[model samples]
Target: MAVAPLFGTVTLPSAHAQPEPPGEVVLSFPTVGVSPRLELGNNVASEVNLPLPAGMSAVRLRGVIRDQANLGAGFLEVTDDNGTFLGMVEIPPRSARPAPLPFDIDISGARPKGSSLPLQFLVRTNDIPADCGPAQQLVVTDLAAVYSGDEPSPVTIATFFPPVLQRVTVVAPTDADPSEQQAVLTLVSTLTRLYNPQPVQVRVISSPRGTAPPPTGPMARAVVVERGSAGLAVEEAGNPGAFLRVSGRGDELTAQISLLDNELQSLAQVTRARVDQSASHQLPTGDTLTFSQLNLEGRAGVLRRSTFNIGVDRAALGGGRIAGVGVNLLADYTPVAGGDAAALTVRAHDTVVYTAPLNASGRVDATFDVPSQALTQRVALDFEITYTPGQECGPLIAPMEFAVDPRSTLQLVRGGPPLGGFGALPSEFSPRFYVAMDGSGQEQLGHAAAVVAAVSRATSTPMTPQVVDVKAAAEADSGALIVANSVAVEQTSLNPPIGGNRSAIDVGLPQNLRADIADGLGSIQVFADPPRDRTVVLVTTTDAWTLVDPLFGYLDGLAGGWNDLRGDVLAAGAAGTPVDLTVRAGGSDPFEPPNVVEHRAPWLGIGIGIGLAVVAVCTATVGLLLWRRRRTDAAERP
Candidate 1:
């Protein structure tokens, strides 16, 4: 057989023969939707054919080759349908083929989809592209029939391209309903082949009606885009899968089936009414009334005690015909002590509403049907009764209770005293007074005295007992035996010694006293009045002649201060005076001694005068005598 320059010019090993037996290239499908590859012994060549889908105008061929034996070398070059040269490559030899040599070529312009054409890979002797003139053609095959051609006789060898699977594109729902049995099975199977453990995501979609095969069961309502070979086979192999079963509410199903990128659990939402009320009302007597606002159903009742008057807030009373609101009075007002037990008539306005017994510790629920026709404004109830010691009053502390009906205005009369309960005394009526008396005997006791007297009279029915005493002083001079007495009266006047008793003559005595006896009389008066009760009297007697010898004996010291010298009685033994005839005639012994005024005065005067005269005479006489004697003595001395 003859050979032409093709494939690549084959290179011979420096240590080996010129021609090497033709090597085989095998192509196979590894993954759908993926480029196909060619298998060469222990090495893999990348996919040589990238099929363009139906409308695609271009295809790309790419692959890799391992020299394997260090001794073998070859060249690679491609040619189009017309046999025009396009591009070339040199496959270098390695000590051990180094590694795989990779190559890619644009086959788009060379061939279009659905076109049966011829393409060639020529292998030759040189490892360099330019050294290929003598190169031999390794293969020449039709591209469309590349998959299954028989052997040809020639000095060189060639083989058809290997078979690769076609990938089908489709759309499917990411979140397929679980009840879709067939759809679920088909999806699961396809994913299982592609991924060993089965991928978490699988698309199951519905095919269009009539345009594709009818599904066996319910068709998948959702679109399924399958990618793997098994998926395409399973899909294309059977009637396009069934529509998915709808579950529950379509809305709920749609919501649950809608896929989200993040993993989450499905949730639902749903609506419901509730009531609340509980409280206890404590009565003054230590009892409690408990009730619920919600459970009242229709109407309720309550009991109260003691006639202080139980007040109800008119606004809070619900609008309803209280069947005869009447108050019941319990004798002695003793509550039914421990548990709920007591009865009373409750009145709403004039109508007798409810008559129910109250529990000692519990409350009664009195309910009345309030008709639509009933008035719903302010209403009051008044109870009339005679004075009773104690009574259990209905709901009210007092007999009269003012309550307004429901939906009406409230009439509120303030409960207690207007003063808000404060008690205090004013200043004008406070307790206090003033008093006085006239001290001068003139009794000019003025308007002030009258006022005092009026006050005393007003405050007293009888006179209060009072005592008064007076001390009077007397003085007699020269010849008069008259007593000049100063009286100090003591009384409990506001101003004591000066007034009150001054004009009132409690007692009177002779205002004159004999000079000699006046002292004794003064002493008697002093002793007569007690010091704590009354003032004392003092009398002084005087005579005109007492001055005649007042300075005798150099005054003998003053009469009362330093010395106690007595003077001869004169003027009939008066304190100061000349001798009287009666006293002179009786002689000193019997007549109480006559005054020595004349002798005392003259003697003192004469003695003074004579002593002065004697001194003068003696002084002159001695001079005369001394003169004579000196004269005599001088004569004797000579």
Candidate 2:
């Protein structure tokens, strides 16, 4: 079944992006875009909570239905969160034969509660009797909610969360009181969970520290956390956390990091992004799973025998294997032989996949076809190389090496039915580091580290990003996270097609944001590598270094499901609020494709050194030292 799409303003290059019929917001639920048709009890209904911006006039529900006999009469009943009848669309009771078909449902009378709406749909016996064994197997996906109108942009709990907050100001009183400060930090932490959960170098601004008044753009949203800053001598109403929404365009919400600590279900409701968190190692098929920008050190060497291990996530196998499309492990190795007789063996989960005798000379590789059923949660691949010297007792050791190129890859070519949400991004299956920039300066490094940290936390693994230059990025085969200053962006030629130079834009705004500050924050834009189909490219800037903290805060601050980040670009500055982007005139300097795979090769360097030491111990220099020590001992012998 077509699944609900992951929400995010990701701008994919035409190559990797599937051309869907144009619509405002198209979601493939479960992320992998497939849901099995399970047995739905009599009158048992399924509820799908949709993130529909205001002006969502229609909803198209697509799914598959099956039974002992394909013909089954059933209609989907639709209702609002309040269970208020919103009307239902009738099915013609057609035979849902060979495939899962799509059907549209026109909802009326009830609209979204406020930007987000929950529609409970039930596909059951419309008129037929309930048959337990011969039940109507129904599966739904690819939920497309069409919206009209361009809403004003700004940061809000809704954006930071749901019920998107438009324009609002949150003031917390503080005067060096540790408890109050701690409370504020907690509040920021919760916001970070949604906005930029990564440590993006955010400077805590007390209510009175700034030279200019708190930012209040036409559509701006600011959170001021201080001890008793709200000046509420008495108890106040609304916004459950420790703080309240002082005032803004027209939002009445209260928040504080403590709310999350306190388990404020109300606030948690708005910030639903956290629920989408999952491990990073699991990958869905089709989309490539690789890290080309991870920073790592290597340990090289020569050895008589060596073993290289790799992990394979069985969950990514999608519960079943499909023909023609299975996991493929491509291993490329360069052999540095010291002996004439050498052999190599490779295995997957203890099952020997390939074996070949090393020519005792050059590089060789073997591609392994992995069966899905054979995979487990932590399957490992072991490559063993054995070498024998022509001489039985030789003092010299050959500098033999077999280095698996970083590009040596493991890819899932999924076949068969829809696997649901797996290898899609901004989610667990997505690659970390949409873009990685060169370590040009401390500021860049700091922000880059922060992103790596965030990805690590999100994936529950130590994250390392492969930093690449604009030139290398252009040739990169996998998706990446590219970061640079405005000047660097220009040099790399990854500038946005629309809008004047985003980095070089006139420091003009409704309020004089720059009048008092040196520079504010930064911005991140995600795009597809035009040359690489299905590959995503993220562009972040530190041209205005001073703005790095704010920019980082904005992007990582908002936790939009901790999964699919909605919108094309996410930018934050001195304003401290991250907003989705609208990019145009698509163009970028594709980085080098050599890309990244974060694996530490221990034998790449000193493998021969260890063996050489054994031979070196037999040398004249070693004999001299041994003789001198023995002579000295004899002279001192009592």
Candidate 3:
């Protein structure tokens, strides 16, 4: 009939039908806040602070998923802080716990115009499915855009996360140049502030001969020299070296000298200044002198490049008969056009008095002394001038005082103290003359030291001025105890053959050691003078007694494993007797060995023999004793 419908086996629809999958993911509305601010040249910008609401959150995604069926194929793409695609995770089918979408973005190295990323997701599975209606397609237009600007873009303040700590120590040699010294100081300061590594204190001490007392009287004065006058082609003659001096007629005053290299860099600093004293007592008597060694590293430059101003204590030096005083400059250089013409002018107050042109070869046979007994009974010398290049003559600036009275006994002596010739001082430079206790006077000459402390109050360098007395218990035993302070013992003697004649050797160990000492000779004892000192102690012993050795190895065998002997030995010692031993079972079954039959297990044999014998003896002894005691008691009772 109609293809004979089969009615024998009929199947009906299930209780419920599978719902249709979502069509596409879409946002109800996409809105972007763009302020009225436009950067230069059609640039659009906005200042925005993004934050999530208490109960709501936003997620970013890439590559929209459209499903005509279940619409559950959407997945979220995660990116780094720079908006670079990192990874992606699938959107689970309609489920209770939905996977969270990632929102972080990284935009580093993007194109100049910038790009916007629109995201869409199918909401087939979730507590509240996303409405993917036809009008819900999300279009986030111009999400982010940046324009390159002429000025560097402003950098946002990053989180101030601190770094891990580290320690470092730096050592600077005394012979380093000034620039290097400065660099070291800077590095030390920076490290201290950054990590606070304990800094070691450095003390630089120098002793040069002579003395320099602070200038006295209103007329007493000092001279200061600075790098001056460059741009000349003169050669240094005699190279007497540069020096600073302060003196009066007859006797020379003492001062310190610092040498400079060709780069105008200070090379070495010397403090021995010996100025001649027995000179004429005229208006311009040269007396005190301070010398500083310098090596002008050959560098083409004009003088007067360096500048300095002499400091003066007017009230202390501008009184009495010190009136018109002058300062003299000296240089030792070969005379060329600009080099030979270089001469230093002496200036008193604002007036130039003495002018001495450097010699043709830059040698100084005589001092360009100035007279200063005019202005204020006591003169105050304060002047400034440039030293043109090429005049690397002897003593740069020599400030001297002259007097009319020839009966003056106040002679300028080089600083008498051991560390007097450092820089400017209060006294004058005297000849190397000393009054010997014997009826004889000889000249005493030596480099006096100059000590300057450049410590800051905030420095953390140790400043413990006194030696601290420490009190601690020692590790040595009493009664002729022997202790060793970082001493090592010879191993060969301690490890002779087992029964070999062990010779007694003095060692670092306890005096009353259990190991017999061979005639008080072979024994190595660590003797502690006070008997309570715990200094390092080294003991020499036979190799057979070591942990690796058989007899002694058991000691380590009991502790699971052998480790370094950083600590004291804890095993009990036997006085001429065998030491007790402890052991651990080796096999896995502990109760039985793998092949216990053909070869009886060691522990099994022990257990069998002792266990059966104990039973047999106990049973027999009890029966016999009971029988005898019963017989005696029965007889007595009856």
Top of the candidates by lDDT: 2
RMSD of each: 67.9, 24.5, 39.1
Residue 595 lDDT (model 3): 41
Off by over 4 Å in 2: 1-43, 51-74, 80-100, 111-118, 125-136, 147-188, 192-256, 259-638
lDDT of 3 by residue, 395-438 (tens): 34221211111121121221111110011111111111110011
Question: What's the TM for model 2?
Answer: 0.31
Q: Which ten residues in a row have the lowest lDDT in candidate 1?
A: 420-429
Q: What lDDT does each candidate get? A: 0.25, 0.39, 0.22
- Candidate 2 lDDT over 1-638, as tens digits, reads 22222211112123244544454444443321123233443355776555543334345433333332332655555677687665443444555444444444445444566545667766555544422123344554444443433334322233333232223343434232324433333333334333222222223443443222254432224554343332211112122221223221101111233333233434332322222222223334344443121211122233455566655433333323333223333333445345457777777767777788877346555566754433432335676776555555343545356655455445555433221111123222133333345445444433543443343334322222333455676556555555565555556544332112332332211111111122323555445434443334344443455544554555454443323343334455444545443222111111212121111111111211132121122335334444654665577689
Where model 3 places Cα greater than 4 Å from the true spot, the runs are 1-300, 303-330, 334-341, 346-354, 359-361, 365-638
lDDT of 2 at 177: 35
Q: lDDT (0-100) at residue 545 of candidate 1?
A: 18
TM-score per candidate, chains pooled: 0.19, 0.31, 0.15
Candidates ranked by TM-score, best first? 2, 1, 3
